[model samples]
Target: MLKTILSISGKPGLYRLLSSGKNTLIVESLQTKKRIPVLPKDRVVSLGDISMFTDGEDIALSEVLTRLHEKQAGVAVSEELLKDSDALRNSFGEVIPNFDRERVYTSDIKKLYTWYNILIEAGITDFADQDEAE
Candidate 1:
């Protein structure tokens, strides 16, 4: 689930939380399956904790991803779309029509697609929490 998938700042890719110690947390890279110790000083954010700005209220990243999954039928976003800002925005708008245009930058859209691709490549298609799925 998204809760166990972490995005550590300054790191290249997503990491899966493995264990915790008194001083550091153990994480395995989702991309390479390499384990690393994350210090307390490192900014670690779980994907479940992320949200996107919207007109009414913020939408959870997991929900956004789920919507995207449904919209694309699990197909990964095209590389050409990723590079073109207009195309990226158009694609994202189709998935999340009300995502705050002012707050969600082009970089954020690209990252969303990138993360979605990574998760898909890792065989993680379920973005909903277990409780929510039930």
Candidate 2:
């Protein structure tokens, strides 16, 4: 689920990791269904490998998303929250109260919300809970 999805630097939106090549990883755009070869030099990162800075320790992206999902009662995040920085920060604060405000940019919060919406629309929720159990 979240582990197989990726966000490449300089790319437009999310991509589904398809396979690995000699020098690049094959990925398909979740939005357009178009496949592309991503180089190792690209800042390609699995969503699962992402974590946010917290007061005690960094928390996994999946955990943050789970908190977001629960906060919204399994509904899509509001558009205002995505567009408005102040609202977005407030909402994100409710989810990850200790996320480093100085380190985490407003753009990062917007991207996180957008990615969560995309994953939810693609029916990628079950795996987060499973990852927590393990």
Candidate 3:
């Protein structure tokens, strides 16, 4: 079965969509390779994952949790369960974690434009130099 894996870009452990018929999420320990099954209805909480304000594709954790709540899905993991935990996964049907992208990282248009020119000057985009605007 195809599983959607979710994880911090630099983290080791991954949250995987294992089975959905019963709404189960599989949290796998990348180091020990241990698998922990989590249910959406099991109000659970976790800590130490260290997900930051800029996590989840620049989206905050609260937003993700909010969407989950609207669907009647339990908070799933209680804070007690995740105090010393490593990671989490979503195993709902067609598990596709939504993300909020209203805010983007700080950047200067002039700086970015200049940087793009630098890349072009360095011949990084040599193949597609058909239009400098690109």
Candidate 4:
């Protein structure tokens, strides 16, 4: 589920939590399908725990992704189009109208799109499954 998926800072792709060690967590890269150990010092966050700042309040990543999924009719958005910050912001704005422009950068937007595509390719589209897993 979404909770098991993580986005590590400075990492190029998403990882799936596999197991926990004494001071590290084993994770499998969604892109490479290779497993690696994440040290305690590494900046890691569960997709389920991530939220974006909005004008009124924080919006969960799940909500934003769900809205995007609905908007695109469950299909992945074009990666090429998402490369442009202006386009990314416009697309994201449609999903979360009040998302904080100052806090969310182009890199963040790209990461969200990349992660969403990875999730979709891995057949992790069941939002209900994510909720039940929590």
Alpha-carbon RMSD of each model: 1.0, 1.9, 19.4, 2.1
Clashing pairs in 1: none
All candidates in order of lDDT, best leading = 1, 2, 4, 3
TM-score of 4: 0.87
Candidate 1 C-alpha lDDT tens digits along 1-134: 99999999999989999999999999999999999999999999999999999987999999999999999899988898899999999999999999899999999999999999989988999999876788
Candidate 2 per-residue lDDT over residues 8-105, each given as its tens digit: 99998899989997898999988788999999789988887889888789998888988988998888887877888998998899999999998999
lDDT of 4 by residue, 1-134 (tens): 67888888888788999999899999999878999999988999988888888988897887878887888788888977676889888988888888899998878888788888888887777644346456
Per-model TM values vs. the true structure: 0.96, 0.88, 0.24, 0.87
| Each prediction's whole-model lDDT (CA) | 0.94, 0.86, 0.33, 0.83
Residue-pair clashes per prediction, in order, are: 0, 0, 8, 0
lDDT of 3 at 7: 43
Error of 1 at 76 (Å): 1.3
Error of 3 at 91 (Å): 33
Q: Which of the numbered candidates is closest to the native, going by highest TM-score?
A: 1
Q: On residues 20-98, what C-alpha lDDT tens digit does candidate 3 reach at each position?
A: 4457666654334567776665543332121223324433233333333444243233433233222212221112233
Worst lDDT 10-window in candidate 3: 85-94
Number of the top-ranking candidate, with lDDT as the measure: 1
